[model samples]
Target: MTTQPHFFIEDSLLYAEEFFAGLGKITRFSGRTVTADDIKDADYLLTRSTTKVNEALLYKCTKLKFVGTATAGYNHIDADYLAERNIEWAPAAGCNADAVADYVISSGLNLANKYGFALKDKKIAIVGVGQIGKRLTKRFAALGCEVVQFDPVRAELESAFTSASFADVLACDFITCHVPYVKSGKHTTHHMFDKQTLLKLKPETILINACRGEVINNADLVEVLTAGHDLRVVLDVFENEPEIEMALLPLLEFGTPHIAGHSLEGKARGTEILYQILCQRLELPVEIKLQDLLPAMAVDHMVLTEKYQLSQRQFRALMNLVYDIRNDDVDFRLGLAKSPDSFDSLRRNYSIRRELTSLKIYCDDTLYPTFTNLGFNTSLIKGE
Candidate 1:
């Protein structure tokens, strides 16, 4: 029997080494620190966005057969090179859709509170109508806001989908980006929100980017913010990993170390996606279930009365219990203050954050539809 193919997993994917124990000679390495030499003899590569699986890193890895990224975005992976080498690749796309949407919703609400604006009265634009963006469209529209989806690709591809023009999108009260980072394409998103675009926004526009960093030019953003442009920006991802543009920190309304999809379920779900794909390729039965792999939620059970119904304001308190963007912002700034490379360190030890689906809420049956539409896990109460 040929020695089981070597498996190199990122150490941050907690318990992944053990998860693949039976199938391979597993080695766990920090994603940022792993080099080509480390995977030279590896037959499989399992990694996160932090690890770039490009020719520069994988040229020495002769035995590599399959590469999987436990992330929704695949820009980090050089797909063109992978395809040329006949190496199969897979991304856990949309595995963290709910988690990322939660972050956006939370961030939006936080900004509304600080800016003294009502979300319902605002015209919001979702820049990409993909997984996370689609969920946001539903949630924001359900909350009575006008949502304009700006996805040129989807508009061209989907017969039923409609996209907003760049001019129309510029006039929205808020704009959030969820598109992938494409360097050279008609629909390229890298530095999509550069100085020219950033300056054109209507006054006091709330711009958000949880999708990717270079999607908005960091240096341009710092310069724009420095010039005191009437705009508020929130970022969960940065242009550079581990080391970000330090001057941009104080200018951000909210900044985090790319933890938008760091929810416990989200990360596990991504890994699970890769695991199942690998199992299929190897003709092995996947015995692991996602639910069994998760730990108990922090607030496992919540009771909702008529007073706790889902109003724009009431929902904030509820969401804050699960996540408060302000807290993450503070932590991000503090971490960077401690060390420039504190980004990966912060992500490696990210606190356990459970998705709304992880928490079960007991509520009257009448409100079941409302809660479910907002993506909560709920138990219906019978009328007595």
Candidate 2:
């Protein structure tokens, strides 16, 4: 008799059940206690970064021999403890790199145009040179921007970048952080950019944080803004989700929900990679490709100049052209701030978002000239 592998999931991947059939008998659970119980009788368990997997939980899973997390961050897993127990662990590293890069580039370029400064020749200091950071460097460089990097953990990578110290990064014209959360390490990024550090930034510097919140103390940031610091703060992620200091709300240049890496293309890629890894570990052959898995969506060709004539709400009109996943997140975050207790509900019911690739644009005949002049694509929606 062939040994059957029982697969347990923690209700996070949010993928369709039909897509996961045949690999194993899959069971889904949301509550921690219930999920833990399921893990005890399963041979494999899958989870996201939000679920904490440590020794205590591992000890309860006597039948578990493999673990997989469908997220870029794996800090929740106690690797040292898992190693001693001979359990295999895998994470979807760099899965959302492109998605994040898209967010930064699109938002950055839009802001640049608004500020009257050409993106070309502007210098950027990116902290943390990991998968996402490296991808951002390439994207920014392609747009004719000078990129400097600072990642003490990866000194060897310095050869590819104009690397400098943390102080040097703070002084750059634009600074974006991509560091991970490390609680107890020489390079602990928790509250790394505090009030003292914020004061050092040039008055006109553009400060953007898309990494984990608390990486920069929100309280300190609020104080800096209140004290007349000339920082243009753009945040997609905050120290506390759905909670923003009322005083600081008016000071932010751009604030949105944590959708910087929530693109459908990115999420699907992550899921596909997780599927492959899980199959290999379980000794099953799984063939999954992102292109084959993604559902194509039609893109409407937007004539910026003509659309400019539509409504008086400039932001909303422009947003409608490319509006999808990220915009929904922005609304959800704002809603959460109004109703803090509804966070769980907001996350559970998040609408499925698609990448630009899923869209096919159709430009108006007369407005085609306007789209060409604005450098907007009139043919298709390409991935950034």
Candidate 3:
């Protein structure tokens, strides 16, 4: 009889229980609470970004041969340690690109609505034009917003891609960061937006950071806000997660517990990628499809009649019906004051959020192509 490989996975992963049940004997644990002893005899370990996969946690896992992180960011994993042990590792990059872009568009529209301004009238500066940044550029461009990007590495490779200077980024109406966390190097992103950078920003410039908390110094951010700078900040990731600075909560226009990329489709895609990687490492044939694992969307279809036209505000409201970012904002705001653990708990128990592609919308012919380009499934409806 073939021995069933024992697999250890983080409990927060969506579809993990069902996806891995047939492949091996599975054990799930809280990512942050997992210890070295937990995977002592496990053949494989899978985790999200929350778990720190280092020598300290894996020193006792003598049987471990493969590890996978179901997240785009892998700063938590020590690559050199894994290389020394000859442990094969994979990270699910670009899996959450669309989901994050959806979050940015939703929140951007919300901000525009709240402040009574047209989205097309404002310029957005996107820092680090990687997977997520590229998606944001496409979506915002479709919506007629002026977008400027800053990514030195990508600029070197793609001549067609325009690269804006850091000084130019600071002058924009809104700034969003999507760079990975790099502690040191020529492209070190650690606290890239320090006190000096923050001070240079134009007053009332909206700042959004969903990339990593460390990219912006939280202390500097708090100091800048306290100084009565008219900046509006939206943070999905914080410098210190779970144990976030509570003082910054009241000042934010919107805040979430790092769920910007935790959409149902995104989570499923991450799981599927890791599943494929594990299968390849184990010499097992891949059998699962991502579509097979997804649940039916709670919202299936929407109708836009001739009586109502698709204005920016109306479009935002319609998008909210599919995936409203404010719900997450409210949850974090209410829970953050209660306890530190609430942040992690909120993410672990995040509500089911579907991507825009999951819902079909019936609208006028003029609006169908635009909505389709924005990743919405759309059908033409007669307009009066």
Candidate 4:
């Protein structure tokens, strides 16, 4: 009898244990706590961004032939080292694009509402126009915000998008970064927003960083904030990760533990992509569907009973019922304060978050098209 391959997966991957049960024997360890010896006998190793995959971790895994990261970013994995050893590796790129876009929209709209500024009157500068950046541009444009994109890489290929300079991006009312963590090269994103860059921003600018923590220097940011800069900052990713600078919390309009891409659909999509890749490599049938692994939605449908037409504020409130930034912000602040060392634990224990695609909204005709375009399942209610 041919023995089934053994797979070791990170504990944070949603539905991983259940998804891979029939395919092979599985063992799961905390992503950050995983050691080289833990995966020594495994044929496959699946990890998230927390665990670093390099020579040290793979040295003991003699039987390991395949490695996969269920994330769009592959900076944690040493692809060069894997290629040298003839180990096939796969990363789920653009898997969480929609999730991160949703985060930007939710937070942006919330800030606009709080500051009493119309989104249509604001200009948003997107630092990178990759999968997440494209989604953000589309959504913000649909909301009537003037979108400026800054991606030389994509601008060189696509004539439709005229790239803006770094100085031009800083002049916008809102600046959101979606660039990958590029350590070297002319377009390097490491400390892209350093002391000099941060100094260029106007006091009213709202800065958001969800791409990578190291892309923006936290120390410089803290110094700027401490000096009484009036910039509204929102950070989902940090430089040192779980060991985040607690002092920066008070200065931020919103803060979350790198969960902008942790939506249920996104996480499931990442796992499914890797599953398909692994099946092809092992010559096994790809029979799994991402939808099959998802549990029932916590909130399937919602009804809006408004006397008059639905305003943007009302729409935002209804959307918040589905997915609220404040919940994550509050949970992160409380959890982190109580347990400073439990940064990964906070992410691993994040509540079941669904994407906008998972929700159905019943609203007036005025709001039907907008909500539908925003990826919500919407039905026009005849009665106001």
Candidate 5:
């Protein structure tokens, strides 16, 4: 008889159990409460950001042979240590690109509408041109927005690609960050935004950070905003999360827990990726498909009878039907009102968030591109 793989999985990862059916001995644990003692006997560890898979947690976990995080960022994983132990590691990067792109678009639209600036005419600087940034670039270009992308790593990797100058980035009307959390070196992203850097931003600049909280210095931001600086901000991640700086809340245009990549499809995709990786490692034929695991959406289809207007309000209204970013802000504030410990609670009980692909829109050729670019599933009206 073949030896069965012992697996430890985080329960919050969507569809993980369904994908791993008949594959191994499964043990599910809450990321918040899982301990090294809990996973000591496991042959594999699959987790999300909440579970810190470092030497501290894994030193005693000798039986583990594989480790994977169903998340875009692997900053929580000690890859060097895993490699030293000869344990393989991988992250489901780009799994949440569509979801995050949706968040950025919705947030940008809100800011544009509130600030009286047309999105198509605004200049946007996107820091970190990774999967999420690339999607935002394509979508923003389709919307007629001028986007300046900057990623030093990508610039070095791709000879044809040129990263934008930092000065040019700071000069834009809007600056959004989607970089990973890098703590050391020339390209370090931690505390990239300080009092000086924050002050350097253009007046009325809409600054958005969805990637990581330390990306923007929270305390420095509080200082900047308190000192009468003008920076309209929207932040999804924060420093010292689950215990955020309460003073920073009132200063933000919209503040949320780290849920930018929390779309149902995104989470499922991340899990599916890890499952596929395990399948590959085991040399098993891949039989699972993401589409098969998803449920029928509540608001799955719509038809546009008239010509679609591309105003920020109209664009934002259409997005609102699928997801209202403002509601999250309201819920975030209210959750904090009820209890400071509600940050993770809100995330754990995060409502069903379907991506734009879940909603199919039938529109004429004149309006098809916009909807599709914004991540909607669109079909042209045949007779139109």
Candidate 6:
């Protein structure tokens, strides 16, 4: 037999090696270029961000029946071309929404507290209300804040939520962006928040970008900051990523290595969802065992109010002690700024982070209950 059906893995499939090892004739090609010739005899093609599937590639891979990308962004793949060729494609969507949202909410709330602002009374504006946006809205709303969202695609579905024009969202105290990349279109967010948009915000507003970097013009942002505009900026993504504008470094209130959604649970879930889709599309038995990351030890988190003497005022300090936003910023500046050659290496090998489950908050005399009420898991650090 001709080695049953061949499955080719291009780009790094974080946990795909183990998932495909049990199947027949699986070849792991990490970061290899996925050309037409490479997929000529292959029954399935697996890839991550690096590979792009289009007409040229499809015409070459006449035998390829399935394309599986273990990423949320499908813009790299030509979906229409694949459909015309009767080829199936699958991508993991919304798997990392909570993880991304957790990062945004935690960072936003933490930043607000740091700046002597009350989150409950603030108005938050969110653009591109997709999966990540919806999660962000919920978390912010949970904290007793009003969330105004803008997304033409979701205006009807999100009608229950406060809707607003883009300009209206810009007028809020805090603005968070979550639109995807669009090369060319009426809704192209290529430079949605350019110099003009940046100038529209109030001087005291907090500007956040967790979506694509190009969504905001880097030069315009730097110019605004240079001109004495003191908007607090938090960035988890940047244009020309891994090569952030050096001038913008000093302007950021919080910066990270784009690991906002790098939470252990979310990464594993993304892998699991991708694997299942691959199996179903290829008509094979899913043999991949999706292992959840090791859960963190629990501590008594109830007595937070009593043991730590924490009130709402101290919430920022508590979160900072546990998750330092500045540390991530420092690491990004140091790691990426050291040399340009190490950019790809640093990003691909970025550190693995724990979820909220990994944290351990301790307390005495029922302090655990109080911490849990405050939305923290504290059983690990506490001695039961």
Best by lDDT: 5
Q: Where is model 6 more than 4 Å wrong at Cα?
A: 1-4, 32-37, 55-59, 156-162, 279-323, 340-342, 357-384
Comparing 3 and 4 on TM-score, the stronger one:
3
Ranking by TM-score: 5, 1, 3, 4, 6, 2
Q: Worst ten-residue run, lDDT, model 4?
A: 303-312
Better candidate by lDDT, 2 or 3: 3
Candidate 3 lDDT over residue span 128-190, tens digit each: 999999888888887888999999878879988779988889989999999988899888899
For candidate 2, write residues 138-255 as lDDT tens digits: 7666555788888887885455555578878887888888988786778889988899999998887888888887788899999998989989887777776655554555677776
lDDT of 1 by residue, 212-262 (tens): 788999999999889989888999988987678999988889999888988
Candidate 5 error regions (>4 Å): 59-63, 306-310
Native-to-model Cα distance after best TM-score fit, residue 60 in candidate 5, in Å:
4.8
Give the number of the best model, judged by TM-score: 5
Residue by residue across 1-384, what tens digits does model 5's lDDT show? 988898899988888778886798888998888877988988999999889888889988878889999988887898889989999999997999999888888888888887788888889999999899989998898789999999989999999999998888888988899998889998999998888899998778899999888999899999999998988999999998888898998999998888887898998999999988989999998898898889987777888876756566877887877777888899899998899878888877878587877788999988888788778989998787
Give the per-residue lDDT of model 4 (tens digit) for 1-384: 999889999887777866688789999988778888888988999988888999998898889889999999988999999999999899988889888888888898788889998877889999999989888887887687898999987888888878998888989999999998889997889999888989899988999999889989999999998998789999999998778888888889999988898898998888888888887887888887887676777678877664366666866776686688988999988988898877778887787688887787887876676777676777877554
Query: lDDT rank, highest first?
Result: 5, 3, 4, 1, 6, 2
For residue 133, give model 3's deviation from the true position in Å. Answer: 0.6
lDDT of each: 0.85, 0.69, 0.87, 0.85, 0.87, 0.72
All models, RMSD in angstroms: 2.8, 5.7, 3.1, 3.2, 2.1, 4.4
Clashing pairs in 4: none
lDDT of 6 by residue, 78-188 (tens): 999888889988887876776677677667767776777788777899888887887777667756678898886566565665558887888898888888888677678
Superposed model 1: Cα runs more than 4 Å off: 1-6, 17-19, 22-25, 35-37, 55-63, 240-243, 306-308, 340-344, 382-384
